[model samples]
Target: MGSTASDEDYFQRGNLFWFTVITLSFGYYTWVVFWPQSIPYQSLGPLGPFTQYLVDHHHTFLHSGYWIAWLIHVGESLYAMVLCKSKGITDSRAQLLWFLQTFLFGIASLSILMAYRPKRQKRT
Candidate 1:
């Protein structure tokens, strides 16, 4: 089947949204991991207490990082559900699998879907 203009627009917008999400997630992770010293600890907002606790007690920055990664995973899982629906994936098992994979693997699961997605067929 041929894609209509609206369908193409929807596809482009979805792609752009996913790309933006992934880029921002990666950028935040990189900044936290590589240049954390550049971050102003005093202005960490809600994370200030946790950051101080971890620094003063544990002497490590891992707890905050773990929380951030967990938050990202949760967001990815929610996005996976929306993605499965948008892609017309009706099989319950398939949707569940993708959701779990996306939660566990993040953008890797999205890449897998893009790589293996079936091509649209032409109408006779």
Candidate 2:
């Protein structure tokens, strides 16, 4: 059996630690922006004060940040799709997965795709 271009261009998943941390951070931001009243600020410890302050004094800031963050994620996801195509990741499933992961995890996912260096083929 021999290697194929698909094998060389397969997308790699990002690090578990980074993926988890980024997911949690995004979740927190979502909660803070959409359900600020439900957040137990004191329980957040150091982040509590900042979170409360933002919600109290600058809610628009939080709202803008949330939307902008998602917009950036959308842009990054599109770029990841392009990167997949350029790197010869021809599988539609792989490209869709890349887009979704990058949409959710942003740079955590895109960084992995960016780091990919397709294997060079031999000039037989």
Q: Top lDDT: which candidate number?
A: 2
Model 1 earns a TM-score of 0.46
Residue pairs that clash (backbone atoms under 3 angstroms), model 2: none
lDDT (CA) per prediction: 0.58, 0.83
Model 2: per-residue lDDT, tens digit, 29-104?
8899999999999898999999999899999988998999999999999999888777767677778888998998
lDDT score, candidate 1 = 0.58
**How does each model score on TM-score?**
0.46, 0.87
List ranges where model 1 is wrong by over 4 Å.
Answer: 1-60, 114-116, 120-124
RMSD to native for every prediction? 9.7, 3.6
CA shift of 7, model 2, Å? 4.2
